[model samples]
Target chain A: MSESLVSRIKPVLGLDNKWWWDQAAEGVLAIQRCQGCQSLRHPPRPMCDQCQSQEWDFISASGKGTVCSFTVLHHPKFPGYDYPLIIVLVELAEGTRITSQLTGCEPDEVDFDMPVEMVMQRDADGFQLPYFRPSQ
Target chain B: MTINVSGEAAIAGVANTEFSKNSGVSELELASVAVRDAIADAGLKPSDVDGMTTFTLDNTDEIEIARAVGIGDLTFYSRVPHGGGAATGLVHQAVMAVATGMAEVVVCYRALNGRSGHRYSSGVAGPLLTSDAIHWGWYTPYGLMTPASWVAMYTQRYMHLAENVQDAMFEIAHVQRQYAAKNPAAFFYQRPFDRADYDASRPIVSPFKMLDCCMETDGGSAVVVTTAERAKDLKHPAVIVKGVAQAAAADMESMTSFYRPEIARIPSMDIAAKMAYEQSGLCADDIDAAVIYDAFTPIVLWQLESWGFCDLLEAPKFVLDGALRSDGRLPTNTHGGQLSEAYIHGVNGVVEATRLVRGQSVNQPAKEVNNVLVTSGVGVPTGGALLGRSD
Candidate 1:
């Protein structure tokens, strides 16, 4: 199937979210950093909630974080994902959190506060998404 | 300062349509049935209902139900959002309306084919752009799509903090199922499970076995609200709306609120609980029965902690101590809760609260049940209420 017509769900491409996706596709995990307050945010927003600044810039994070929380989904399988899929809330070193899939480990192997590093994982259609893995 | 409307409005009637996995009828019909029954339970004609309210998530609107039920000339109408969290807030709106004379008789109802139609457990299929959808867009593609997955994120963190997370979760399921065994209306009706069964159930999301999840039931529940004085002339003894509150913290998100500093704490619940106590002038110790929302078992413990019935880290010990039994410290969900009973959102919980207050609960407590605390959905903007007997 063509990348654009793979029948796999993809993030809604919009003015606020397109930049992050474009950056992630290039193998860099970028987050919105507010120009007014330097506050970093994930799942990009139109305005910096803290400083109310519509002005922002993207910063490529260090790709390192700790698992603040996680869940292993085992039922009602969806397309483009495996069963017992590990989803994690990673608190980035820069002090913001993002929800992403965690690969390279068993469901029981992931623990809270475990150090992880972000890596680019793509959907069947070739859209890259940020996923995390345990750091040695 | 929050205006305390305690004892101003009373729940004169509470009724529900048959509980089922599939009602085989439209949500509108279910709403009409539940509303008509609730009004009759209050010993009032449909014409007496001049106002109506319900949750925004409910497919059946007040006007539609009003039209079908023959309720005329609504002086007040409103809808509270936040999914099941608005269950008790429906009472809050109705009470506020009746207390201020905006409406004399108000009916609160929620109807949906949650199972047969839009199953919440079945994750959203989307690329939608509603504000809520925007939040889901962030993680749904990453396989964090369903409500179970979102709650599991924090529940896993909760497990790390608690001494016996798995055992505690299983015990909650076991206790509620035991209650369900006695209540014929429960989805699990006579199918009680042991701890072994809970442990062996299929895992939907980590830290959440199949037993921990509430059945997505298709049904409707409705309650009637009126001035406390008028309730004295009603069919059943009045269940006073002592206090009602809806609260959300600064960082509160719909369901995935992991971005906050403390993902384990349900701040919205704590806020609502605090307001319930303050407005009602009653503490956790005064509550005789509680109908804590149990869409997921872990949430029951989360709410017990948030409501200050026990310390945040003491819920497991609290549960193991038999605190949820009919003769225990806080006999909870005497009607089996959403975990075992029908998941009519949390409105069924509200109805159970009225039953306990009226001494009509199937699993009535050993002691006199006076004040019953009914909490709505957690993991989102939540609401809480304190219902009590007038004397």
Candidate 2:
């Protein structure tokens, strides 16, 4: 999508979260995996809740998940986005659930338990975000 | 340690600004007016008020309200965090303050121009620098930026498990509107809606038509809390604070705590339900009236189940069985709630609960109202209070 056509909702790049955005811009979906217990966490936090270990690093996600739930938002339209936006909560193969937009699919076509894979789409804000689409 | 603060404090007065889409006044002015009215209703002067409390998101500060209301306070001012979830928590804090002699007269208020200025429905946009905002950043990039979107994640999963839940949700909205129609103070006064209207309404997030979402209202509400002993000499009947509690489950997020064992069950409220009953020595069956927060319609049913009003999967039928009617087994949100009344966060529900205990509600239930269950926000770390008449 062209920059002019996209609506750029910028990410908040804090000291703890800037890395996650950097990884997404590189077309990779990465999440925090506690080195102490290997328990994966999303919405990356500073320390591992499972082990309370401050020492942790990111792991590349499998890019595959199933739709645990989904919703189509129609009101309060945002810029650079289509009406009737589809948002999905996916249970990733790596045992963590993530929230991402489902693109390249009709609202009626999306359902619970549907398989999807991650794809990178840059928003008008000049930053890339991970989006999911139906997988064969 | 049980730490029973039950009946130690009581709500002596309640007041509210007229519900409107635009109040044409500053939030501080709204706070001042409501606080003054509440204090006078309690038969107390401004000098009698020594403490104040409100939510952090509320734009008006305690000192600002004190100055505007001509209150000269020296001790006890606090702010509770979280959004609508902090409603009953405000009472909890006041009860603690009054019970412990930290302050004699504590007033809790929430005043906001939610619809006219800084509408929450417009969705949040900020520096995104706070810890909570940072958490929201993960999903906002994907177009999940609004509160409705956050709650829709759980609603969709709930429907998957309870196939016929939509019928119950539609009925809940319709019935609440019916109650709202009777409430002269309600935003939807004289305008009752039915199932067909719910279906015809525009979609907000899936599973939530326009009626499913509460109106963003510009209003303010205030309550007065003092020791039970002091309340005995006040103008109106004292509504004893039987139980006050704030609870958060493990790994609780503000709104999007979706990784629970059951995506549908509100764990924080479950914890709150247990705590409130334990503190008050009252059971779910003891409640004659309830004011469950209705920021969204689906949460009301979720609360009914979490609070043990019915089985987890039986909430749909429980509500469909006329459970919310004025003559039903448990009348709920008789003031129409945020959906039809007004959204001053959930503090308005607290005021309604007080009115129920005082037998002063516009839509008072037919049964002799003794105990009332009031809840804060749901779909997040939540709180609840059980209020009863101080016979």
Candidate 3:
């Protein structure tokens, strides 16, 4: 199949590309911080879940955390995605947990509590996808 | 306000479409078929139903369902969010409506073309970058993208906490598959899994094999609820809605409740279990059977522990000892859970609980079941309810 055909079949959201590219240019990993609790959250919401407060501020994180958990995907659900991609749940120092893919090492090398840091990788659409790597 | 425990509600009717990897039907059609079957099973007409409930993720609107089924008027209708946790919560809403005389007869339904339609296993995109996605974006940029990948984080931590915990997660998958093997209506019926099969299965996330995950199926299920009095007059015996409860804890978020003090604990489900136990006036020991929402295998372990069936860190031992088997102390998911039967957003679990109480389940327990406990989705703000055999 041609590239445009695949793009038509699996449309990529414009909002995601803009946000990811913005972070990559700045070389900073940011999360939406709920104004009410001053806590970081994922899947950015219009309102704070803790206090139902809608106000949010972009906050840069230390980008340092331990691997709370991980999975080695042997079956890629989508085409072009290779086998054995390390998907991880990272417990950030800011006291929140988030899910992402782990890169920079072999799948077997990834373990629980292994200190990891973030790295941006470009997708087929030139959108930067955040993947993790061992800090050491 | 005191709920009348003696005056219970029953599941007078049950119905569902065939479970399969592909169902050549729209979600609306699937839902209608299940609803029609349920009405017929109750020996009643669609016009008789006055109340309805379903999950938040379901695409079929209540008004659409009401119109499609040709029901004249609706007195009560509700939609519960939070994935699989809405399973028994649907019953909770229906029972309250019936018990309060808000609606005489209520039907709860869930329909999905999960496999042939939208597959949840697909990777995350920017639209998912909502507040939840923003949080995951921080991590996804690093690598966690799917539900199994997200849950794998907690499961690994749980295993790290307990050394004796063998592949107990496999025990849960194996049991559900075993029950499904005997259930002709199950998606995995006639195909049983063993420890070796589980081990050989590809890993989705660490500690979770492909076999550990629930299969995506295209199907629909509906249950009819009516007052004990009305149910007694219907075509089947009344399976009383003994108790119902929905709960969410502080710092609770979808799939990622790790910010709380104890990442391993499910405080929301704990609260729901306690409320159900107290309201029903029945202990865990009184539950003759249960239909725990098993969207993922590790959740079953957490639910069993949180419900006080066993202490923390002992869920593996509980399952390995055959405690959750059909003939075991607590027969669970007798119709095959989301793991083996189908994942209609946990509504099928309500159907199984009703069948157990009605003595119509394919994997009926050895003992006479008086109390059946059914739970909704896990890893999010969830719901649960207890169904009893009316006297």
Candidates' lDDT values, in order?
0.86, 0.86, 0.79
- The residue-by-residue lDDT of candidate 1 on B20-41, one tens digit each, is 8878766777887788889889
Q: How does each model score on TM-score?
A: 0.73, 0.73, 0.72
Candidate 1: count the clashes.
Answer: 0
Candidates' RMSD to native: 21.7, 21.6, 20.8
Candidate 1 — what's its lDDT?
A: 0.86
Q: Using lDDT as the measure, what is the rank order of every candidate, best first? A: 2, 1, 3
TM-score winner between candidates 1 and 3: 1
DockQ score for model 1, please?
Answer: 0.01
User: How would you encode candidate 3's per-residue C-alpha lDDT over B1-391 as one tens digit per residue?
Assistant: 3655434677899888798888865677678778878877998888888999998889888776666556768999998887777888888888888888899889999998899888877757546634565666656776777888777778878887854454677777888888999999998889997888788999788877898788898999999988889888889888887778889988976787777776776889999888888877888888888899888888888888878888988888888889889889898988889899998888888888888988889999878998888888888888788888876
Pull out the clashing pairs in model 2. A7-A80, A8-A125
